[model samples]
Target: MVPDDLLLETRDLTKDFGGFLAVKHVDLRVRRGAIHALIGPNGAGKTTVFNLLTRFLSPTSGSIWFEGRDITRARPAQVARQGVVRSFQISAVFPSLTALENIRVALQRARGGTFRFWRSDRVLEGLDGRALSLLADVGLEDQRDVAAVELPYGQKRALELATTLALEPSLLLLDEPTQGMGHEDVGRVAELIRRAAAGRTVLMVEHNLPVVAGLCDTITVLQRGSILAEGSYAEVSRDPRVLEAYIGAQA
Candidate 1:
């Protein structure tokens, strides 16, 4: 049985791609309402773990439990419907759509409305207030009418985050949220994430150690497809093995 404080749990999770074992016997537990980070060097299978959690890829072994319910066999849509939503490493938004329009579309989907582009404009207008609020939450209110493709790269990522927030996920999975950005944009997005995580749980695979240290409540370090250390930033940062496997490798 999963503990009451745990929002998500994986037991001995493993993934095998033919002869290559990408992830092996991993146990992950994300506490409710905590910002947890998974950090690792290249090919340490951080993204693979995210894929398995989101049901984008099937796990070769082990079980996934969310809110104490086994979700190992759940379909991707089913998992999403249950409020486990993920954002990719790459920014994902409608390139041709205006920022407001993009957010409105996400609102429609979240509210279970079918996509009906031909619907009366008035029908969609009902969602504008909420969409605008979300845009403001991400500091993109001024760009509401700007096309996503035309927005600067940082703003584009912020827009993508807004759309993801529309889903109102209980457990939000962010993959490399600050993968490509300047220092200023990184700080902005980091603040946005902190605000967005107020009432929800976040599990992220992040490469930026400073962001992970500042934002994550718990950090899990992976190396060669296995967990090398799991603890607070202070604890794990002092671990000699973690230093050698992840921090040292990066240096």
Candidate 2:
């Protein structure tokens, strides 16, 4: 039985790619309204776990439960509709669309799982207020009129975050939300994530340990596709196995 406070759980999750075991016997638990992080060196299968959770890739064995429902075999769209929305490791945005428009597109999809491109502008305008609010939530309000391509790299990522939030996900899955970001941009985006995490659960795969240390309430370290350590940042950082395998001398 899943605890009332747990929002997502995976039991003995494994993924086999031909003869390669990308992920093996992984158990992940994400508590409701907490910021959790998956961190590891390359080839640790952090992304693979995210794919399995969202059904982008099927696990060879094991089951995934979200909100107490088994979703091991749920379709990608079905998982998304269940309020599990993921942001990719790369910045994904409509280049030509303004920040507000990008968010509006997500809002439209969230409404009925279809983009009503044929709908009259006036009809779609109803979503503008909500879209603008989402943009503001991610600190993109000032870029509302700027095309995604015109925004700086950090703002582009922020816009992507805004769009993801527009879906009203109960569990937000962020894949390297700060990848390729400058120092300043990292801090900004981190702050945005902290603010956006209010009242919702966040599960992120992040490489920047500082960002993980600052933002995540619980940290799960992976090594060779299996969990190495799971605890608060301070606890995991001090774990001898975690330090030797993943953190090296950094801890």
Candidate 3:
């Protein structure tokens, strides 16, 4: 079992791509059952860090520990099986599939049943109840039969989230969960994430400051691939270096 004290931790995490240091020495700590936000301006390497953590990119150096075990060398599938899952910036919904079918695929994956993909989808009837419940959890019950591509942009994002939750992840890494959402959709997705986080840990990279302030218990601000500040929203917002970084980024 992962230690209750720290569900995920990084030690001097760094990543370089052909001499271009995308992520510098970074130490991240996420507590069990907490919502943590990693915020920074563009080019600060937030996504690069996510890639390293998920094993999408091999780190030039450093280590990642999940559930108190070193996962720096683990494959993406291996890390996912260890209960760390991530949602992409673009919704991972299948455009041609119905929302329910999309969620069923995730359920099948969580059960390591992907090998059965060659079989008829009717083979997945046993997962319907759980898929329906997940749909309801994300307020997509009414649209369960709708094609993912036909749903509104916001609902598509909701569907993506439901699929991720299907994995029963211990640590859910959301890369910009509210990216490109309008005001109403942003509020809705924020609430959805809030509700989904119960009994699990969430570490997200979000640019929506209000959403971060309202939902996250801890915030780590990255600048130029290094931590600029670490604190609550109020505390980080007040930091001069963070203010300068944002200002400089915008300029």
Candidate 4:
């Protein structure tokens, strides 16, 4: 069980695009070292919430606290520097580069340098070694030299994970990390995500209910830009409103 002390909390979080409200007032929390799943139908304000967290879209009027700091108005880079980062559904990898090279670039970005010493092959090798170790940790060491674009679909996803892990984030915001894959691939990615969940908090927006049931300690259901229900899988699944909006035969 995750401790009650929060790692992320959104108080009346909201987002408006010109006059249309993309996301309504939202109150959410993610605890340290917990796999919290956010599930909802298409256009259910899931992505909007992620954008707000990452500061991609400024909230209209609300507060966002991360690791106990108010960051509702932080810039995207500022938020990333604070260890709040998200993984994209589409691979954000450098497809032209080898897996090791991709991770090397991310490592330098994480540590805040890559172009400092031009002639130091030793430093480059050190960076390569660290990237290799991280790739190995993500079970992608065998493909270290393989170009990211040439990898299979699942492998591309894995590469994306490696790049994100290189950021060493305190909280991971994953948007459909297992989207566009087969059942076997889904299970594999789920396992990989579980492996990556050590020592950090993870929050995901997933439509796969089985994945949510298998991995989430708590699930929040959203509909029409508001949280419809939230609780244990069984608890929320049994709620009449959730059933009607997202859990019944139609759901």
Candidate 5:
């Protein structure tokens, strides 16, 4: 049984593709309501780990447990329904849709109302009030009517996060939540991520060390598909193995 204090745990997680082991025997534990970060050099299998956790890709070996339930074989949709929702590396917003509409769509998907296509727009109007509230929570209320494609890149990501929040996930997985943004946008999104993590467990694979240090309570460093070090930012930053790995990856 999963401990009451733990929200997500993985045991000996491994993944292989045609004799190429991408992730190797990863044992991870995330505390309830804590913000944890997975950091590694390039090709360290961060993305593979995320895919495994979300059930987007099945593991070649190992077990995944959430809230004391074994979910290693759970389908992607089933895992999502269990409150483990992930935001994509790329924005998931509908470019053509207005920001409010995009959030409404996510709210509808969470409520299992997507099949009601025959319902008039008036029916969807009921979602507008709730959607607006969500947008306000993300500081996107003024841009609610703006086309997602036309919004600045940072705001686009905010909309995507708002949509993900619509699912009311207990465990949220973020993959590079602050990639490809100007310094200002990075700070903004970092704040947004911090706000989103309230009362929820967040496990993120992030490349920006400064952001990770600023926001994550704990950090796990992976080197060549295996954990090299796990600790707070100050602890891992001074580790020789982590320093060597980062240097080698850059070299």
Candidate 6:
């Protein structure tokens, strides 16, 4: 079971691009082995928060604690090595490489062996099994040999998750898994995400509220740059402010 105490925490997190605040003094607590969703309109600083957690952007005046480690100013690679890794909202994969090879490359990178050309041309130790298992886990076992670019949009996203899984991160940060997908494709991908959430800690920034309601046990809604509401789907969705700020858009 996932720990109830927070696996990732931020104390008054803030970010500034010059004088403008992209993310305000926000605080977040994500528990271990649970699925948590972050939702907001465009330009609400969801991506900015991701950058801070991954060490892609340093927080302006906040401290980030992850799995009990203070990584407020850690390097990107260091963050990944410490078991917090992120996947993009858009596809981030090698277009020309096969799904199997994509995961193989990530496995090598996770172990810091991708650059060791001096070793024989053989793949990293045990990577074949790991890559195969990852591909199978994402339900792409049959497509393992297909070039990543040859697959449809949804498959590309699955490939991205497979690559991220090869890194063996304890915490997974997903930008948006359902973006640019058709109804059937969205359902398929949602199930894929469900599989991923079983034993992994997930923090996702998603725009689709219905999807969030169906999948997430807890939801955080942001407006402008800070949280507007947080709770279960029914609790937050029924709030008058949430309805005014969000539901009015679709209705």
For candidate 5, write residues 100-137 as lDDT tens digits: 99998878876666777688777788788889999998
Please report, in order, the local distance difference test score of every candidate based on alpha carbons.
Answer: 0.93, 0.91, 0.91, 0.86, 0.90, 0.86
Tell me how candidate 4 scores on lDDT: 0.86
Kindly report which residue pairs in candidate 3 clash with one another. none
Off by over 4 Å in 6: 1-4, 249-251
Per-candidate TM equals 0.96, 0.94, 0.94, 0.93, 0.95, 0.93
lDDT of 6 by residue, 1-251 (tens): 34448899888999988998998888888988778998877888999999999999999898999988889988998899888989997889999988888998888776666667688746454678889989988889999889999998988998999898888788999999889989888888788888888788899988877778888988888877788898888899899988987677547
- Runs in model 5 lying further than 4 Å from the true structure: none
Q: List the residue pairs that clash in candidate 2.
A: none
Query: What does candidate 4's lDDT look like per residue over 1-251, in tens digits?
Result: 34358999999987888887767888898888889999887888999999999998889989999988999988998998899889887767898999998888777776655567755646556688789888887678999999999999888888888888888898989999999999988998899888888889999999888998898888999888899889989998899998888856353
**Tens digits of lDDT, candidate 2, 1-251:** 34888999999999999989999999999999999999998999999999999999999999999999999999999999889999999899999989888998888876663656676677768899999888777777888899899998888898998898888899999999999999999999999889889999999999999999999999999999999999999999899999898878344
Count of residue pairs whose backbone atoms collide, per candidate = 0, 0, 0, 0, 0, 0
- After superposing candidate 4, which stretches have Cα over 4 Å from the reference? 1-4, 115-122, 248-251
Those runs of model 1 whose alpha carbons end farther than 4 Å from true positions after fitting are 115-118
Better of 1 and 6 by lDDT: 1
TM-score of 6: 0.93
The superposed Cα distance between candidate 6 and the true structure at residue 29, in angstroms, equals 0.8
Clashes of 6: 0
3 against 4, candidate with superior lDDT: 3
**Cα lDDT for residue 250, model 2?**
48
lDDT of 3 by residue, 23-65 (tens): 8999999999989999999999999989899999999889999
Question: Which of 2 and 4 is ahead in TM-score?
Answer: 2
- Order of the predicted models by TM-score, top scorer first: 1, 5, 3, 2, 6, 4
